[model samples]
Target chain A: MRWDFASVFDNTDALLVGAAGTLRIFAICLVLGLSLGLLVGLGRYSRNRWLHIPATIFVEFFRNTPVLVQILWFYFALPILLPFQISPLAAASLGISLNSAAFSAEIYRGGIQSIETGQWDGARALGMRWGQAMRRIILPQALKRMLPALTNRAIEIFKMSTLASAVAYVELLQQGKLIASLNYNPIEAYTAVAVIFFVFLWPLVQFSYFLERRLRRDE
Target chain B: MAYQWDFSPVLANAPLLVEGLVNTLRITGTALVFGVALGLGLALLRLSPRRYLSWPAGFVIEVFRTTPPLVQLFWFFFAMPILVGIEMTPFMAGAVTFSIQSASFFAEVFRAGIQSIERGQWDGARALGMRHDQAMRRIILPQAVKRMIPAFMERAIELMKTTTLIATISYADLLFAANEVSQKTFRPLETYTVVALIYFVVIFLASQVARLVELRLARSGESTVH
Candidate 1:
């Protein structure tokens, strides 16, 4: 009948460790997912059938399935094919990174496509190669438009770090589980976890919204 | 030695997988219906002229949208029952968590769709002596609902994918079934692969259908809301 956060406060060290673990995976997935997404997005934009087809398939396959399934598959199924077992961090990171890549590829593609054909023509008129033009001219401009969406993706990746706990990874949610079980304070334990997440993510969400509004205003 | 791939064990447990899939769909359907209805209510309250109504609705939407669904699920499944002094089944917890989680998302879609309607329609209805509720029901909503369809389908597909998380709470959804089959048959590779493929096929097909609807809406010259 009484709400007590004292137990949760006493376990601050555990939560801090969990926060570090969550941030580690989030950073790994964010960098890997978004950077790789640029390549896959380019592939989707490519005229070459080889590049386009495989990119399409990759995006479709990864985007279509639930990410937890991917993590579990990597953790349980993939080890059988490999010479060694997959670490929880590796499996969770791979699953989240690939899923984010698939989703973010579309964002990248849409951003690139939103650039007018005139931009491409101007780059071509300047004797710039495709890669040079993409890097110097097209992407810089497209990235501005993609900023809101990409930030949204980053927030999503942060939230998804919790799924690492499902594999018994030492993440925020996993640590929360440990604390709750040990202290028998599920209410305080879980509430603290949720509040911690909300504290971390609310600013990012607000930033994305701000970016979206600015983009809308500019356009 | 290369690991040998085997499918016989997974195939032998087709019925279990099927039941798991059915449970998955059941949760998705239950959550989708409630999510949409509650989303509409939330959106309406958010759009209310009164600050008291709009503020609380906005708060709910923001909190739900900002937090991780897994954390929400855990809180509901593990924490809520004891707080309220009642027992909750995994299904109940999953349904409640997903419904509210998805409703927050759907609320935005509804809000955007409603706002996208030209202000002239409302003025026209007013000129025709229609009350606010009457105009909303008869004039505004019909048009907004059409624009919202593509977004609705997209969110529904997302909801289905998200339902997989219930397995972590020991619900016998498709992913949980895969775990069971893998352990029982000692064929984790084949079992997980089959389950993943099943998810891929169903979700991919749903996505394609959503795309088709979106394309059709575009061709019909009806601009849709996200």
Candidate 2:
């Protein structure tokens, strides 16, 4: 069969809706994943066994498994283990958030560990408590140091959200597939989806570059 | 419905999984070899003084580096046939996609390694009557390749992990086998856990190989440093 660009363009509203859904998932998961990552990162670095073991296991399991499998597990396996049923959207969000947390935890740990010992010592010498020092001094610097990496992770999570389509979530890719199946124009539909990703992703890439340059200048 | 944990069902399908494991390694190994070759070429192209050559190479690097590999893979598998009238088998599609996606990152790694070599080395090689290619072949590349070992190892491990994506397009890799078993046996958790363990083993072995190369490089570096 021949390619049809006109047919794909004719269904622009459907594609736009899918793009909106993708952005929503990305925004929600970014916030949730970063928060979870911070907690787990801090937990992994903590001396408490209660915090460390669980955090380590969480990071290792998610990081090691293929994200598609992890998405499958959340969508299929979790409801069997848990008491409550979850919507596919919720499962997709949770899966992405959890997977991203594993990666972000490592990034945060690296950022936090990169802070000089003298910074902590000085904070403590200034009569700040451990929490006070971490919250007031170490964390601010670490966050700045980590901004570039964190943004990169956010972009990754956004890309990975497309995998949710495999589990039957009507994200951008899923919508593209639907359009392709109906129109029998896989190339144009998928290409359109890719362009949508490119448009959305290009800004994030620029932002990451800007952050990296700014961070280097500050250094 | 109560679920019972049964390893036997998965064990019965071990042969399929084994074949899948072999296929995964085959794809990873082949892609790594070709990817490095392509990457080296691209790196040289980028470092070439000629802007006409380097600019296009640079664009390829950025496009592949920024775009997700899965999307690229789909484009290769799905779009290439329409665009070029050449249909690729799933395995061929996987290999080409992996290699292309990998070349970009490997090119960056190699470029960084090459740049780390001092300019004095180039001048010294020129004074010794070596042609540009000869100088690079005999002097520059040996040192750059050695410095690039760690980064290349890290990328290899990443490539190993990423081979799982091949399963998406129905290549019978370990991940695809796990999905098959999970669907048939309804024990996705166990099937996926086993698949993850197998990946860990493969990646761990790749890491070990990296370590050995690193040690060998260090020994050579020490001898040269003296």
Candidate 3:
């Protein structure tokens, strides 16, 4: 029950492996999630039901469900339902990426919607096509506007990577749990993991604030 | 191992799930009330002219706001007990963590709401011979609280969703109940689907209530100023 910082760090390489796994999953999910989010966001605003309804349902289903459940479903239920087998890491990444997409889609939609109607009119007045206006004029500004929300979501996605540990994905928390089980020192093991997370998370938090202030000043 | 989708086991265990749901609501409700109170105090402290008080208050808000709630919950449930030599039951630990986590966000909401009120309003209150505390109590807080309703409602919805994290610390909340059923029947899909549906109903209802409140507030012509 005593604090044992040295014990936790004795196998530092093992912990670093867990950290590397955490970073890998986070990076993969961020890229995939952001891409999917843009598609879903555009789909939500589309006039056709072909695009909008499915995107709407996807957003609602993922957004409404507990993320832990979503992780469990992908990691457990999907294999039985799917034709081929997937690795645990793949399942966890897919689950996190898809859920993050649902949220990011909403963020992008909000950012895009916040752009003024006059700006759209102004673009039209300049004889730009819809796609041209969106790509060249609207999206840049919208993306800039969404940087705060996007950074917050990225941090959230990074934190949620820990949930992958629940399904035995051997992320930082799972590694901590393994050490705790072995050593019967949950306090030290988990606290060390928490400190690791805090170290990773603190910079992102500061960066987001700095970016927000800079953006405000720019405006 | 093939997992089948089955609801019969979960349905038979309805009482357990219902009990968990009740506990979930209890934790969320209690946490929301206490969090709001703490948030208001913290918000006021942050706005205070006293540098020592406001600086620490600001730091606490920043720390809590940035860290994941799961990490905070784990630290409180595990670390605090060892450090303080006081063991908290899982329910108590979850409640305390949720309250502290919710307070940080609510404090930010409150601070924004308070700061949005024009300086002219404060000057006007001062000219009427009202002291600072009296002006805040009678004029500023009421207006700030009104302007804050929409944001506060959104935060409440978020807090409700976050209550599921209590399952991590052995609190028998809705998510925990679902996990129990899933383990018993190995029907992760069905058990979680039902759990998600329950959450959707609660949150959707809350969203409706928020809209109604927003409508009522707008009708009263207070929302126009913001």
Which one wins on DockQ?
A: 1
| Pairs with backbone N, CA or C atoms under 3 Å apart (clashes), candidate 1 | none
Off by over 4 Å in 3: A1-3, A84-87, A117-128, B1-6, B215-226
Alpha-carbon DockQ of candidate 2: 0.39
Interface RMSDs of the predictions, in order, are 0.5, 2.5, 2.7
User: Where does the lowest 10-residue lDDT sum fall in candidate 3 chain A?
Assistant: A71-80
Highest lDDT: which candidate?
1
TM-score: model 1 vs. ground truth: 0.99
Residue A105 in candidate 2 has what lDDT? 98
Worst 10 residues of 1 chain B by lDDT: B1-10
**Which is the winner by lDDT between candidate 1 and candidate 3?**
1
Q: For candidate 2, what is the TM-score?
A: 0.91
Candidates in order, TM-scores: namely 0.99, 0.91, 0.91
Taking the tens digit of each residue's C-alpha lDDT, what string does model 3 give over A65-120?
A: 66776776676666667788777788888888998899999989988998998988
lDDT of 3: 0.84
TM-score of chain A of each: 0.99, 0.94, 0.93
Candidate 1 structure quality by residue, lDDT tens digits, B10-87: 999999999999999999999999999999999999999999999999999999999999999999999999999999
Q: Evaluate model 1 with DockQ and give the value.
A: 0.94
